[model samples]
Target: MSLGMACALASACCFGIASVLQAVAARAVEAGSASGVDPVLLLRVLRQWRYAAGLALDALGFLLQVTALRSLPLYAVGASLAASLAVTAVVASWLLEARLSTAEWAAVATMCAGLAMIVPASGAQGQHPGPAALRWSLLGLALVVLLIGALAGRFADRPRALLLGLGAGAGLGVVEVAIRLVESLTSSWRGV
Candidate 1:
């Protein structure tokens, strides 16, 4: 597998688990709250603890992403973070005692299949920087992702948590693309 693909898969796996952990922590906080209190107020209090934990995780994730970006291309890193939704779904269900609908399960399976299909077989040629086609493709895909995530964010029950996951994914995607462009420019400069 190409370095880019490996980086993306790594991002996906790590970010997925992080999302789930965040969900689990949130559910635990909610469950531990007492009755007859304003949820917003309780949540503000809870943020003290949850945000601290989240910040630590976020720092670790950022470091990993930076290390990955130094070696991988843009698309790989972005796609890996896509697995965050699946991670979130599983984690939320377990922590909140929520049931997963068949549709959600199907979505998770489909995502995995799609990732598998994009990944090259063993010993396949490493990905070359393509023409404008690949760049436009990535741009178009990013736009579509943003639109879908916006729609989902609109109706999300835990909007705060959900938005964090979406934002993190989007941010990671953009960072990867930027890193790839920077790497290309530096490479061309050295060649000149």
Candidate 2:
């Protein structure tokens, strides 16, 4: 694979792990609350320091994602981001001092397999898209993914989040593939 593709795949792996961490962190915050407490209320309950720390972690994740995008294709970046689930799992295990159950591992495995299928398998077509098209397409796909994820939020839980996040990730992967294909076709026609 080319450096760009490798970066994208690495980013996807990082993203998967990060997602898992976020899940673990979220559950911790939820579990820390008193009985019958609404999760929405958890933020208010968190002291300023706690909130800041959480926000910092989120910022860190964003930074890593952006960095990865610089070296990878859009689809690669998206797939890596979907990988946030794997990240969440690892972080949860370490922070909570627990191991993922067999069922949870199985679910994560399935998600990773799906991600592999979505990411581009070839590196020969290392075409770069124009800034405008890349921006608009990514924005559109992101909006759609978030919209779908939000719609799924009503059914919030680890499993639901994992599935929804993967759905969003797949959307991103498809966009990248489309972009690469278009770039190849346009470039070929120009050559002709």
Candidate 3:
């Protein structure tokens, strides 16, 4: 396999393993009286060795993902990242002894098959530097997310959780494009 593919797979593996570690750590720590999204609970989880290892793996995964992005197209990288779900399922099955349904196994197979097709067919990364406006728009989105997060407490528990999830998803999407755009911008500035 190519270096990009290797990096992508390694990144996925790191993320998958990290997921299990973090989940285990989260469960190990008992929560306090706060019924909502408790910062203290998060802090407690942070103290766990498993969580620390998970965080380290997450950082490593991100770096490997960036390396993969430098060589592979965004879609290909995305598909490869999706492979993390498959890895997570497998890892969870093994470590957590979580029983997988036949459908779930089938889904994993389908995902793996799709990845097999994607990695081999993917071309080198495209050179287009995205529009300048994207940067400002992303900033705007981030500010909006922050506003939503600040106002989240106003809503009921379910709504607050939903709002936070939406905000997080949007924030992650922003990161997705921003990382590539930043890379493009840097490469352009370097005249590479």
Candidate 4:
């Protein structure tokens, strides 16, 4: 449990810092040169040191997240990941030199409070092998998300952010489910 908690926290911190770095790099790019969803923007961002660092952090975060997911319940892992927003808020204030209003600080506190409540209630990952139907459903969902993201490529920045954010959230959710599914499969294989 302690290791899981550590991994989760590490994941959150890495993701938070990465987000701020990536955002800063993206913002530095000139506007009106390319669509928000353009691959060229990614190429441009990659030229920035901040973006490259952010990508490295993202890779580290993903490993930590997987470690956490293996040991903790999906709910616990999910909540911790969601709490990355609070980490982002802090990182933005410190590294990005952004001011946090009183209300924003309170919101971060609220998020921490909520996480405190969740961690205690969370248990070990369940042993049950979820239904095959669920796996198929998740696959379908992934395909649908890819389609939506492709379509969103034509959209402007504001709408593109919303769509991409939603897609990313969904992708993370799918990762949680996939972890559970893998656990179930491993358990079943061991039983055999």
Best by lDDT: 3
**Clash pairs detected, candidate 4:** none
Which pairs of residues have clashing backbones in candidate 3? none
Candidate 2 residue lDDT tens string, 58-173: 66655555555555555556665666667567566776676899998887788778767755562333445566776677677767777777777666477677868787666756
lDDT, candidate 4, at 98: 97
> What are the runs in model 4 whose C-alpha is more than 4 Å off?
32-39, 155-161, 183-192
* Alpha-carbon deviation at 93 in model 4, angstroms: 0.8
TM-score of every candidate relative to the true structure: 0.53, 0.46, 0.86, 0.85
Model 4 over residues 71-169: C-alpha lDDT tens digits?
A: 888878888888889999999999889999999999999999998887778876666777999999989998988887887767887898899888877
**Rank by lDDT (best first):** 3, 4, 1, 2
Candidate 2: worst-modelled 10 consecutive residues by lDDT: 177-186
TM-score of 2: 0.46
lDDT of 1: 0.61
Candidate 1: stretches off by over 4 Å: 1-4, 24-51, 121-173, 183-192
**Top-TM-score structure, candidate number:** 3
Residue 151, candidate 4: alpha-carbon lDDT: 79
Q: Give one digit per residue, the lDDT tens place, for model 1 in 122-150.
A: 23333555467767877776776677566
Computed on alpha carbons, the lDDT of every model, listed in order, comes to: 0.61, 0.59, 0.87, 0.85
Question: Whose TM-score is higher: candidate 1's or candidate 2's?
Answer: 1
Q: Is candidate 1 or candidate 4 better by TM-score?
A: 4
